[model samples]
Target: MATITAVVNLDLPGPTISRHVYGHFAEHLGRCIYGGFWVGEDSDVPNVRGIRRDVVDALRALGIPNLRWPGGCFADDYHWEDGIGPRDQRPRMVNSHWGDVVEDNSFGTHEFMDLCELLGADAYISGNIGSGSVREMSDWIEYLTRADDSPMATLRRANGRDEPWKVPFWGLGNEAWGCGGNLRVEQFASLARQYATYTRDHADNRVYRIAAGAHEDDYHWTETLMRSFDPLDRDDRPATPFQAVSLHYYTRTGSWAEKGKATEFSTDEWYLALSRASWMEELVARHSTVMDRYDPAKKVGLVVDEWGTWWDVEPGTNPGFLYQQNTLRDALVASVHLDAFHRHADRVVMANIAQTVNVLQAMILTDPESGALVLTPTYHVFEMNRGHHDAAALDVHLKGAPEKEVDGRTLGLVSASASTRGDSALVSLSNLDADTAHTVTLDLRGRDVVGHRARVLTAPELAAHNTASAPETVAPRDHDDVRLRDGRLEIDLPAHSYVTLELTLSPTPSQPLVPR
Candidate 1:
């Protein structure tokens, strides 16, 4: 068997992996809100106060730390006031951004906050800046978070919700460089500063405002935004314009017009998909360098608020729904992107996958008419790697690089990231090669292995996915190809698989002066 060796140093610690890094994004596109997650109380969709119960329970099980709502360009067009009063009296408008579908102001602020509360997840509210006024944005914040007897707060109370919701994260705008407003970097920066200036704090909830940021490799946008905040510490600048700036990148294989379907793809497309997924590493590294140049202190974070594979909408579905099947390739993509996020946790404080349900690389797929929900392969990967949240990332070194060749380009075969919390350590490993199984020898240096368990997500075919008929077509299974003996862990990793190994480490010896 082809072998790859790795040594994980328990003593060498990297940055603390933030739980918020495993965040999710929920847009108001297609069925993501209406039929996917929020099937009204009157519907027979097994809902908890209008929110889908199965979706809520599934996301809750994954320990979702935060969820960004009503976005992906939808936030820019949304007017918050129209969605607050009685449902029957609410105004309806066309969602010109996605399929031009009619958006009945049914699922608004209250419904979103309720869903977040139900899932025990933090709400990252993306404010409307493109078509919304400063007063409108300010009043929206006041309505949700303000606890005082202000006019907006009073209106919120009269709407039926007496208590204020704790909205911790706020996006001043989203994608201002494009659909957000088509504004230049400086224009977006100035408008963001002005809009963020009036957004007041309520009670103890101090919102973390995120300025709309760059598209892929747009270094100038990052630089300009950073320069805009250069005088933040000075007496003249506004009150710290933003706590974070976002970067949006998607792993879109092939052309936009010819974007391939989610499941029906050749092995060539699979290899190309893996290659595109690996680009995230370079993006994060280059973006971090630019961010460091401007903010040496690393006070501001780099939030990847929008990401994931954007394939063509599923066949026969609404072209704007962006519904795509999740396969083992997507699972591997999640592993790759998540591992990159963990490595750059020092600066990449938070990231929200493009969407959470019925969208690009969604975690759960729901058949609204049938009330059937199926967890995707990407969901299992997230569930398996939950231990990495809030843990300290550790350094791991590989002895030799395992590689695979697809077409003319060579791609690395493995991605491994380790993290420790208290006495337990978790390691996530992915073999990117589609046809090579690797037996890996992991040297658990300076740690006594007490217990070990493995879970793997893979399938016989690269394009295997769970359809409504066969929901378990590509699900996780208990893996026994791993063994821990005398501090060394041996894993027989399968091709095109993502595995998570949980290890219970014993305390290190108090006195140690020997160098191996």
Candidate 2:
């Protein structure tokens, strides 16, 4: 029996948490594209323009802000021209990065943009720099975004599309230190400057170019990028033609060859996953410190374009697909990382979990063999905490909270962050203990909260997940564990649970809510 106390001040506002922080990444690996998102219009699986209707509907419900397509090492090797024109005429290529499977080029640029349009999300295109030429990259940009009658635009129109799509976010390259290009930081910076310079803005589409950033605690990489780009600034303006830098880190328990299983972990591994995921706070803090040295005004945003737990592939699944199950552990991981992002909203403008479906820590998993799709625990976390989007983060402090010892390490018993939207304040809390439920006393800084609603995502087992056989076994349910009396809120936070509390403050006089 443990009790934790926290205080939140709604008046103290931080940066508006970017909705793009909830963005999703979809790569060209495994069933992530072919079997997960697209099922062909002729198939028995209900589909919209060849994509699974259930998948599209689920993502739309999540209010997906943006989607990054065609890479995680595949983008650098992909040639956009081969994916255009007629489907039969398109050439099939070997995806050297993932499983060595042949990519039919059936779902290419057109399909990705179409999917984004359907989801009502912005498109973040990761371009090829490892094996693509400057002319090719520039032409691809023109073909998708150019409004004028250029050769690439004309070719695009001749293919089928009458109007160009709006692609606001562009990745100069992905993982240049490894898959994108095996080059030194200086060489990569040189290429980023050149390639990003040619990524033009057509019509109303202003491109926000993001430089390829460090993998983990690569402080030198961030320092080198900021230094190289520093010389490109003139009159407090960027001359390098870029607006942001990207960061990627994945949570893993063991070595790549011996990574632990996803849904078969013990309490120790569960704590380890959450503790490692919490490292995003340190990563963002240190990286933003480096970015501040060069761009103190915070003009250059830090985009965590790829992040999530990565585990060994499920049994009998293709190893290259990076497919794994999502459980309550993953929901906690999402909570910690999201809370960190909210706490660091000043510098962390956006973050995309890797990825959206049928991939590492995916939101939705689709069974191509059976036409079944189940939303994972990670999906419920996103759906429950969607209120933080576009809301001003409020100041929150936790005290009298102790740490739990697990497997030679200690982690906080609880983590919390708050945000204010109009007349309501949203508070998200995570209880990391595996056995003990904590009664949390929330001090609202004298704000009059007339009403409240809450939802909790938890299960009796730590490894509990939603399978095709039992899709609703692990989902969010209306929580009634909160009580308010004498202007103080008390919450019974179940162990290993993620809770979201929406407090309605300052209700109108004509329609006052009854206090409970």
Candidate 3:
């Protein structure tokens, strides 16, 4: 084994992990909307209001700081009022776009806001901008958040809620490039100004409006939005109206339509999927560069509100709903993406995976027939990495060779990042190679290290999964450890494994190292 030394100079500075980055997204697509979160209040399984009790508890355990609701493609055509009123009285609409299913707006604003309350999370409402009027988008803000006197507020009070939910984070639109009207950035920026104008900000309500940005690496859209922010706004106020800029990214498989196989796939396919997730680094850098040019002092941060793998659903599910299996490989992808977000925490402030449950790489999967739920392998990674939330990103340098080559492209086997909370520090690492085990040394040279314990979340196979029958097969190990000495730690990482080490530092680690 090559003994590479990762000298993390404790004297330098590191970034601060954004709590919003550790967020979950729930969209009105497939079971992600119906079977995933909403299962009717009369079901045998535990439920609070319209949301699932088990799902709420699981999300709380993951320490999800923010939750984006009613989105993805679903946000484009979604009408807020359609999902309000009495569950029985609510008019049913054809979800003509997603899987051609009937969407009874029973789980609308009140339901989503109520669910966020249960999860102890901040609500990120994606406003209707495409094919919806400025009044429609603004009315939603009034109906859900406004207090005292307002037609929407009065309707809200009649619906049985006394006080406003006071939701802080609101997304202006979903995917403007694709499902969200397919307009040029210039056109969309103008429409955003009209929609944002209506989103009422009451005296007590502090709403942060995030304008729709590009999908993936379309920095031009970001550039356009940045340039047009002044022209598109009723008020050229960068502080309140344009609180944040939103971007969407989905980790694609080797292909777009058939996202390869979710679980059963080749190593080459694994590299193909992760290689795309690894591009988050560039996405943040390029988007931040654009934002820097427009708002040089870094006023607006890139909120990657929609992100996750888009693969073929498990066998025979609704194709349009984007339901895919989550595996150990998926967990590594989540880890790498989280690491990227942490590294770029300055600019990339927030992120939310596509759908939290029963859609794409969900943390929890519900078996409605059996009234059972299984936490996916990707969920375990989220649970382990929750330590990075709101914590200061510490310096971590890796001294390891590239894992392998996929179609002439090199793959990174060892992935690592550091975060600190007061005097305690945490280090997370992942080895994506399936065949060879690695004896890696983690050198925390700058930070004054003392004693630490490691927890490993790994699997014997890269294609390992956590089914309803065997949920614990790929769960995180709370007491796993690596051999650590003064300022140095050595770990034995098996092929296709992930670990998070909790180090109790002698002093608080704050100086971020300038990456060499």
Candidate 4:
């Protein structure tokens, strides 16, 4: 096995990796909301107020910090009022965006809030801007956050929710350049300002309004949105029209018209998928540079609200549902993207993997026929890296790391990122090589390590996945091929694997230590 060297600068701590960076997304598309998270109050599956219990419990275990809801493309066409009041009395409409199915409005504002509560996650609601008016959006915010005897507040109470829900993260729209209405960047920016103006903060709930931003490397779109921020107010401070902007990206091996399969892929495609996911680092850096010119203080965050692997729908499934099987390849994609997020934690404040359950790169897949819930390989990555949430990012420098060429692009065979919290630190690593095991050595600096533990997630093949009957097919297992010797940490990382190391660090000494 080839050996690689890396350095973990324990003293050089960076920005706090926001817990929100490990966020999740649940769109109305596919079975993500209906059967995945919401199985109704009468279903045989154990649930709490119609929300799936198994799903919530599994996600809570990962410490999911926030959840973006309502839609991907479906948000723009969704009318909030239609989902309120009595479930049966609520208006039913055709969900034009996904599968052209009828939406009964059963899982609406209250239901979403309840789900968030159960998982102990913050609500990141995407508003309807494509077909709804400013008044409608304003009233919805009022109804959700208002505390006093206001008009919208009164209406909310009448609907059975006596107290308003706290909505911290509010989205202006989703993908305005496409499914969210084909408006120019300038037009969308203007609309964002107008709509955000009325999204008031009520009671103790302060909403962080996020405007729909660019798609992929649309630097111009981000520039336009940043330029549209309201000029300095009377106090000579920038007006808070929106706290952050959003960007959506997905790892697809082929064009939109022909996304590759979720399973049954060749080795070339595996490297291709990883190479594409690695591009997130470039995207974050480029976008952050643009934002730096406008907001030098970095007060504004870049929320990657929609991101993950998007493959062709499973066979016999509705194409619009976006249901795809998750594999070890998907887990590595998540690891690489998360490592990028950690490296750029200063700017990339929040990132939500698309369709958290039963849709594109889902954490859990529920069988509709058997009512069985299976945790995907990608889910293991999230659970393993939960320690990085709200932790100080540690700089990790690699040397002699292996690399491979894929489709005319260089693909790094090893990926690593580290973060320190309290007296413990987490180091997550991924081995992209399919057939080669690597021995990795880390030169730990600035702190004394008291102990260590490690785990590995990998399978014999890249296409290995979890199913209802065999949920542990691609799960994590305790790794014993790791040890801390002298000051260096050595780890034996197997091929097609994701590993995390938990290090117990001693407190900083008041004086410098002499050479032992």
Candidate 5:
């Protein structure tokens, strides 16, 4: 085993890691909507007005901050009016993006809002800009948030909901450079400003409008969008059209033509996945640098609304469904990305995994035939790291950390991130090596540790994953090999594992940490 030393500077706190950074996405793709979250009210599966009960309960336990809805490529094609009226009266449309399946419009505005309420999560709605009009987007906002007797508000009342729903986040479009519309960055930036002008805030429900941003390392797309913010309105004030920009990245071991299998992969692929996941740090840094030239105060956020592992579909699953198995490798990929998000908390305000249930890198997977719900290994990581939500980020510096060579490039073998909330602190660690364990010595500075507890999630094999038959195959368990001595903490992390240490700290004179 290798030994590594890390320093946790608790006193040198950074920005508050927004709880929205722990957000989730639920698109109208494949089983993600129909069988994953919504089973008809008359079905045998237990549910709360068509929303799956087990799914909601499982997500609620993770303290899910927000959920982005009706998206990916579907949001641009979706018309809000088709889903508002009675279920039987609603129109059916072909879901061209996912599968050539028919969308019954069963799970629409009301259903998504109800699911968010059931999980105690905020709604992040993505509007249609590719195939819909500006008035349509504006009316949808009024329909959801207006308190007065506007036309859209009256329609919302007739549909059953009396009070206006609070929509905290609104996405202008999904991917304007591709499925959203094959438009250039300049075209989309101009449209974003025009559409955002009418996405009015109604009553007490304020919307954080997020414009669709670049993919991967497209720095030019980000520059074009940020340049549009230079123009001032009539009052000589900054005409910032959007409060944030969206970035989408997926950890794929293979090319887009052949996104490797979810479960079947060699050791080289494992290292490659983590290597790609770690690239998030560079992406955020470069993008934020571009945004800094425009808004030096860092008021705008970089919302990674869609990110996760995107492997090929399971053997028997439909290609368009994107129903892939979540293995221990996928869990590590999530940890690496989350650590990047934590490190750049100042600019990376919010991030939603590609999906929540029964889709690409889902937190929960469901069996359509048997209605068996199994929490993915990725889900356990989110539940374990929930303490980092809305906490002040603590700088963690590591020395002598091991590294592995993959495809002629070196990949870090260990990952760590820390945060403090009140009298408690959380440190998340991951060991990317698949064969050897490592011992990590944490130097705790500026805080006296009163108590500590640890938990680890790992499997017997790298490809081990959860199934309906054996749900806890790769779940978190209490780890007792953690000790604290003389202001130093030591933990034995197993190979291909994720661990979280929670420490109870003695109060200090430095200011009380406030959550954003």
Candidate 6:
């Protein structure tokens, strides 16, 4: 490992990290919608719309604030009407892209919005533009969100729900630059305008209409959306239809074709995974620059709905199913991503990581055969860092580095962020070096931290993970190893580990840190 800079400035103002940023996705592809979160209504597992009640309860326990349903690729072909009323009567469509499996429109509009209610989450719908049209998109929005007592509202009431869902977030399409349809911005922009025109405002609802946004680091696509928005309309009365511009990014350790699925990978592989995750900064900076040019008021929020590492799945699992193993490395990547989100909290209002349960760095995985469920390492990171959601972000200045060197590549260590909640202050720090642990000094200059103590979660190897038999392998522990002498707090970070320090200003000592 080479010596590098780990400088952090905790003085910049950042927006509140949306609780929705901890949101999840569920696509109809693979087991994500089937055996994963769904179990047939009477399989001795209990379900709603073939969705497991246990899964719903667990996600609610994790405080999942918002959920995106339908598809990444699957959303393009989904028809809302087919999924209502009777299950057996629903039409079966072919899932051409995913195992050529037949889709039994059993789980559709009403089912998804109902699940949102069960999970107590805000609903984010991805409209189909590639295969769906202005009318279909318009009607679906009307069916779910409109309360004007229209035909769609009557249809919804007949289907069992009397009130509209009032879903806050709605996407124009999914991956327009790729799976949704390889449409140029000029083409997508016109299509977006058409759809927004029909999917207009309804009652008791102020939908945050999200335009199908750019992929990673694609500045020009954001440019087109902003330019096409044309703040000044034909009547010069501000006519941009979109409330939020979106971005979709997925990280890969290596090209998917080069390597097959495996639980254990090389340090190089681990580094590659992390390096891809680190691009959150670049994606935001470049995209934000375009928004600055056209939408200078920062009125439209940035939404990154589909994200997370897309690694190979476990053996014998459907590759299209995307059932991959989760590890400590994934957890760390999650922590860093959350930190990045906190840093860029101003522009980025909401995001969801690809598919939730049983797919792509999932928070939880279930066993259909054994009726078992387990929380992945990625799950724990969200639990630990969830405190930052809706909290003000503070910038911290650091003077050191956790430099990493692998096969001619070098990167720094020591990433940090500070946030204050009410009277308590907290700092999240990560040692980004894979081989070298560093002693970090946190200068709490702005606020007066008198008799407070430090709490830490760390490990020496830094790549440690948890298994079913050994679930405590990567759990956080109290670091008595921390020292807070002279108001200048110092702590030791293990190689490539993450730690959260809560600074309390109580005159009395709280209990010793509990490592639960």
**Candidate 4 residue pairs in backbone clash:** none
How high is the CA lDDT of each candidate model? 0.87, 0.88, 0.79, 0.91, 0.91, 0.75
lDDT of 5 by residue, 289-335 (tens): 99888777787899999999999999988999999999999999999
Candidate 3 vs 4: which has more TM-score: 4
- Stretches off by above 4 angstroms in model 6 are 1-13, 46-50, 232-239, 259-262, 405-410, 450-464, 505-516
Q: Return the TM-score for candidate 1, rounded to 2 decimals.
A: 0.96
The C-alpha RMSD in Å for every predicted model, in order, reads 2.8, 1.8, 3.6, 2.3, 3.1, 3.6
Q: CA lDDT of 3 in candidate 2?
A: 74
**How well is each residue in 1-516 modelled by candidate 6, as lDDT tens digits?**
333223333334466667877889999978888777666676688777677888887788778999888887888988888788788899899887777889998778877887888898998988899899899989888888777679998998888888788788888987788888999888998898788778777876878888889888788888888887756424555656887888988777667584423357767777766776777877887788778776666777898888887777788887778777777777777777777777777788888987788888788777757767777767877766766767778876556464566435554456677776665666777776667767776666544454444444545444565555655666676666566545456677777677887765433344332221
Tell me how far candidate 5 lies from the true structure as C-alpha RMSD in angstroms. 3.1
Better of 2 and 3 by lDDT: 2
TM-score to true structure, per model: 0.96, 0.97, 0.94, 0.97, 0.97, 0.91
**Candidate 5: misplaced stretches above 4 Å?**
231-236, 508-516
At residue 181, what lDDT does model 4 achieve?
95
The segments of candidate 1 whose C-alpha lies over 4 angstroms from its true place after superposition are 231-239, 405-410, 484-487, 508-516
> Where is the poorest 10-residue window by lDDT in model 1?
507-516
